[model samples]
Target chain A: MRLLSHNLLQCNVKNCKSNNFPLKIQVDKSNIINCEFRKEPLVKLIPKLDWNALAITVHNLAKNKEFPEKFSPALLDDQKFMQELHRILMETHIIEGALICEGCNKRYPIKNGIPNMILNDEEV
Target chain B: MATRPENICPPEIYYNQDEAVKYTNSTRIIEIQEQLTERCIELLNIPEGEDQLILDIGCGSGLSGAQLSEHNHHWVGIDISRDMLNVAVERESEGDLYEIDMGQGFNFRHGVFDSAISVSALQWLCVASKKSYNPVARLKKFFQSLYNSLRAGGKAVLQFYPDGAQQLEMITTAAMKCGFGGGVVVDYPNSAKAKKLYLVIQAGGDTREQNIV
Candidate 1:
């Protein structure tokens, strides 16, 4: 699954609705692909994002790479920052792993580039 | 399209292997699905000149996703049928597809999607595949999660082949309980063969905005 979708996903556990975000990523394989870069979408998306969660996801997904510890509005114009955002959001992928919710500890599995987000009856 | 009593089984089982392949290969199904998808997208009043994050619930074989791809929008689909999604993987679709039941609540972040659409889906939720399932409760769960995932002013156009007026009422009432506003837009109302029901729901958008494309 692309970090783009991962960044927008959270635990669906009933009571954990308040703050089940920044799902902790534990991966065995990571894939990086080349996709055409367009800056407009990312700029429009920044306002809707959870900056802290995004920073953490990038940190885990882009291991050796660097991302600002915090989100800066000025980075929207920085070509380099936008490129990084594009890479992590659109290119980097998790092929096999599990996303554990930081809030409720619910686990969602990832297989074949698709995240299996089906929650058990109890969680629902 | 003849009614299939096979609806009694869960989608994953009913759409398995041969059924999935037949659906992708059938010209008639593809034509109807394509038209339904196009009609739904037209009802979703998303302003142009920007890429949108669209959620395609019950996206089968990426047919609906293909329409979004043509518009140059990024879409993520969730489906309950794995066999149908296998056809989508074979096509190398541009968007991401996931396996999940819409009857259950969504695992998506709040207000992440700019718009949403469903084609020839949602009606299945009316029939209980399992003894534990309740149609009204399931519809409520789906609409509530859809409302939370969408941006305040975003629109979600669901084109469903409702079993009857009762099913349509149940679905709309569920959406209204979740603060969704707007009404159904029917296409080809005079022709039963081409009739389509589109639930054009807007999440907290200004009521004065009456522009319908």
Candidate 2:
């Protein structure tokens, strides 16, 4: 799954509330695609993104890249920053991994780049 | 052909590897899926040449997702079937894919998607596939989360095959209870084979009377 999608996902295992969001990514394999950078969507999506969570993901997955831990409106003016943000959000894909819920510690496995979010009856 | 797959088995079991591949490769199924997706996008009525993030619930093998890509939209697809998703991976589908049961509900951070679509999928939630499954509660959960996932003024066009008026009422009522505005649009109402029922849902948007059919 892309980090863009990951940013939107939260753990929903029964009544496991509090810190359910930003499921911890355990990456076994990851890949990157070269997508044309679009400045408009990235700028628009900035407010919706959890910068701290995204920064952590980038730190964990793309160590060579420098990303700010906090978000700022002025970051929109920096084309370089927008491009990096776009690359991290749109291009990076987690191919194989498990997303562990911080609240319940439930492991949602990712295979073939598709995370399995299906829960059992009791979990629901 | 007389019996629906949703009635026969749950999505994960019904769309096993063989079935998923067969469904994806069939020229007829592809043609129909493409046409329905085209119609759905038209009904969405998004501004031309605009890119928006879309959510595809029950996006099987990325057939409808291909249409979303063709329209230059970013999409996240969630399906219950692992085999179906494997086909999507093999095709290198552009959208992010996830294996999620729509009945149990998904928790995407509120107001993330600009719009959403589901083709021939929603009615499955109305089926009591397992002994533990309660159709009413499941439908309520599905609609509630779907309502939460879309941005304000966002819309979702869901095409489903309802068994009868009762099923239609059940589905629409659940959506309405969750604070969705808008209603069903039945296409090709005179022709049984071509008839398609689309639940055009608007979340926190001013009600528009256009396309009431």
Candidate that would win on TM-score: 2
Report the lDDT tens digits of candidate 2 across residue range B25-78: 999999999998988898899977678889999899999999999888889999
Please give the CA lDDT of all the candidate structures: 0.83, 0.90
Best by DockQ: 2
**DockQ score for model 1:** 0.71
Model 2 stretches with alpha carbons more than 4 Å out: A63-65, B207-213
> Please, what are the lDDT tens digits per residue for candidate 1 over residues B1-213?
677433668888888979888998899988888888888877876666667899999997988899898888899999988888878877766678788889996868878898999987888898988888898998989988999998787899999888879989999999999999999998889998888889999999743254552
Interface RMSD of each: 1.5, 0.9
Candidate 1 residue spans exceeding 4 A from truth: B207-213
Give TM per candidate. 0.92, 0.94
* Residue-wise C-alpha lDDT for candidate 1, range A48-100, written one tens digit per residue: 67778788777776673478887877888789879978888888877788888
